[model samples]
Target chain A: MKSLQEQIAGLDDVLSARLGGTAVSLQPIPGSVPVIQVVIGGREELPIFITASETQVLCICYLWSDEEVRADKRAELLETLLALNPSIPLSAFGRIDKRFVLFGALASDARVEDVAQDVIALSDNALDALEALSAYLV
Target chain B: MSVIGKILTLVRGSAREIGESVVDANATRIYEQEIVDARNAIMKAKSELTGVMAKEMQSAREIERLRKEMIRLENLAVEALDKGEDALAEEVAGKVAACEAELEEQSRAHANYALQVGKLKELIKAAEGKVREHEREVAMARTTESVYRATRSISDNIGATGSKLVSARESLERIKRRHEDLADRMAAAEALDKETSTRGLEQRLAEAGIGGDAERRRATMERIRARQAAAHKDA
Candidate 1:
């Protein structure tokens, strides 16, 4: 079995290969459960936190807070998210600490490049959802 | 005001004001009346064209008559000169000159009349084309307006039906959830009954009577052994 650092290194290699020269890095945050901060793109990098075990790797991107949504428009915003959830391949909407998030998970044995692509795609979808629902946000 | 005074006041209104009021009061009727008036105008223009053509023909005949008259006077002047009548020839020559000038003026008048007739004919043709174009445009406008109204109505119906469909789907989802809950409850109840029922291992063995069967077989075997012993003693 590969150590957690070695697995993260392997993931970093895959991300580098898939994104060409887009600059991807994985930095470990010391904790009870293993956590890695994944930074992709340029100097103003968007960070995605990844938690991994021997069996699965989960990736999460914070989108917005519930407080940003207007009280009257919350229901419409939630409905739009629910309606869009099934169509967003390999990712789903979730709430944590009163903040909306986009997340996806893959088996550790699966292709890291494919999961990285999914993470990028999910991030784009999250940005699009924010733009579409901006009218309902403060 | 009295009815007669009201009537007199209405009669005293300007013709254009009365016409506008009538058109406003009876729009559809006025529209049909306008179509009739337009047709009458076309007929009147056609009659005017015919009258101009008739006047042109009369001017042509007058010109021909003046030309014949000038020729006759020239012939008379030539005959007076041949007969050695100098005064008569001179008088005829003067009449011939006067007739030539009159013919020139009449020819000019005839040309002007012909030009007017041609212009009037062209005007009538143009007016006819305009009338037909206007009729086609009005008809197309009416059809387009009707189509627009129908499309709006269909969109309204779709909006109404869309809401109904959404509510129906929500109701179906609710019913499905309730059915699943009821099925889970029934399954749980059946499992509970099986767990609490009093049929245990000893009760099932007693129902089969295994202990009674073993006692009967042992008694039969002992009797058979006793009979064998008695026969041996007697022998």
Candidate 2:
């Protein structure tokens, strides 16, 4: 069985290449739920993970405090992002604190670069990570 | 002397004169009559004053009662408004307005009721006109309804007669079908009789051996019998 850490690391490598501001690290958050943080678009790398059910990929992101994003607005962004990434099978989505959890599939054909760009577009920044992930997955 | 002072002096003099001698009958009589007359005049003045005060008091009481009633009505209107009972509020408002108008009219109508106001008759006349208009509307509706009912009855009768004719035609077709069925039975009986006769003839012909190898067999038997008899005789 592949460990959650290894899977997260694999996802991080894909996210880093697609997003490309050098991956700061691919380390596990020490807790019941597994989480991997990757740096894209300068300093802040967002956390991504597989949920407890492993039914979907949990992408947790924080809008920088000055960005002042409301949850409903963020949920709208997540919906847009999920729409753009046809490769990912989005199942469920939610917002906690300031982070968003997008539950969906992460397969070999997943468009990581486009997902990264969608994230950047959803944020104030414009970064396309899906393109970098395209070669790695295919 | 001026009128009131003159009357007062005459009254005082009459009182003094009466005190001098009750037995001086003429003077005493004048004094007594004057005193009674003065007392009656004073009493009349007092009664008139009392009447005026009483009327003022009654008017004040009426005004106070009207004020309290108006306050109560206004409060009721407000409460009705708060409850969103605008219709009720308007009804109460109409009543209050009518009461105010009536009060004004009543005030003008009297000093006393026998005194008439011009506006009162006009209001009554307008109200009567409204009632007449409403009655006219009701009568017109009744007339229209009668006409409608008459036309409907006529059409209904025609429709019913037509429907009855359709029903009768349907029944007549059913009877004709029954008659045709009887004819078909009679024709079937005739066909059956012909078939029976033909069958009887065929049975009789078969019994009589008209064909079907029976004649050939009979001829062969006769020849065989003859040959046997000839052989027997020869033997």
Candidate 3:
């Protein structure tokens, strides 16, 4: 099988059909690794970033940054995220320094539909996370 | 520490400071090497399992040879007894007993080797699974660095001039606006319903100085004043 990066890079027309009505599009972000930014139809505000190595396919959707977070509600927001993590399924809350993100990983050999599902789920989860935690933002 | 462990530690120290350095290059390399080590461990176990399997085959062969020898000796003992050679029969019987004991020992050895083979194979299988998981973690950690750079650049671009990526606040703003719109729509619907009702028509007529509550109130006020004047005159 091709690397997940390449496979995701080629996920243009099929995932949209898989999603039924929601359009799915991908852009190959040029960098050190093969990272593709996927913007699903309904969740256009949240674009998922995916890249794969020999062993794993990782997808991440950034929710917000610390700078965006209100200082007074920071603790409350962190607590909310931790409390909500397990229930969200498939994805976990993580912070990339200042950026808060929801990340999910799967084996590199997963099918394209599986990857699409992961991306969709992650994107949905990200939007929910943002909306639920919006009060914490500046 | 694992890359994830390192990230958690850094995050705990100060989430703000844990940005691009969550899994440094060295930590990532170390993590990749751990996958290599796990694979090597599985290979060693496989080799050991092979050795155990070989020992089991040899022990099985030993047991088979002993059983054949025992069968031959028993036949000889029976023949000696039939030919009126009691002492020869006793000697053959003793050799047969010795063969039985050795056969029992070989069987036990083979069983132990078989058990070890099963255990080693299971261990190797589990180790391989662990290695695959670790490899996945390393892949994610490495890819995350690229993500880190990309997001950093995005953040910079947004700060310099807004990008296509809408902020969370913007989405929230839209959501709030929708709620406000719903409130406004509800109020407008109520007003429209009232405007088309019979009561609304009466109120509009009164306000327009047509014969309604306004004229009746004016006549009642005049009658009250006349009654007050008649009472004053009688006083």
DockQ of each: 0.01, 0.00, 0.24
**Model 2 regions more than 4 Å off:** A8-12, A19-21, A41-52, A64-93, A97-138, B1-235
Write down the lDDT of every candidate, Cα atoms only: 0.63, 0.46, 0.76
lDDT-superior candidate, 1 or 3: 3
Candidate 3, residues B1-235: lDDT per residue as tens digits?
6657744565465533333565677867886788888788888998898899999999999998998999999999999999999999999999999999999999999999999998998888888888877776665555555555555544554465556556778865664576578789999999988777967778789898887678899999999999999999999
Name model 1 segments beyond 4 Å from true.
A1-3, A43-45, A53-55, B1-235
Error (Å) of candidate 3 at residue B223 is: 44
- lDDT score, candidate 2, position B157: 43
Give the candidates in order of lDDT, highest first: 3, 1, 2
Model 3 chain B: lowest-lDDT 10 consecutive positions: B10-19
- How many clashes (backbone atoms < 3 Å, residues ≥3 apart in a chain or on different chains) does model 3 have? 1
lDDT of 1 by residue, B5-78 (tens): 54344335553343234223354355446656667777887898788778878878988988899899889989
- Which number leads on lDDT? 3
Query: What does candidate 1's lDDT look like per residue over A11-74, in tens digits?
Result: 6667767767666777665544455667665412235666554445667665666666789999
Model 1 chain B: worst 10 consecutive residues (lDDT sum): B163-172
lDDT per residue as tens, model 2, B98-195: 76876665454345422222333444455455445434433333322332232233224437547321222233344346657878999999999999
Give the lDDT of residue A39 in candidate 3: 77
CA displacement after TM-score superposition, residue B143 of candidate 2 (Å): 78
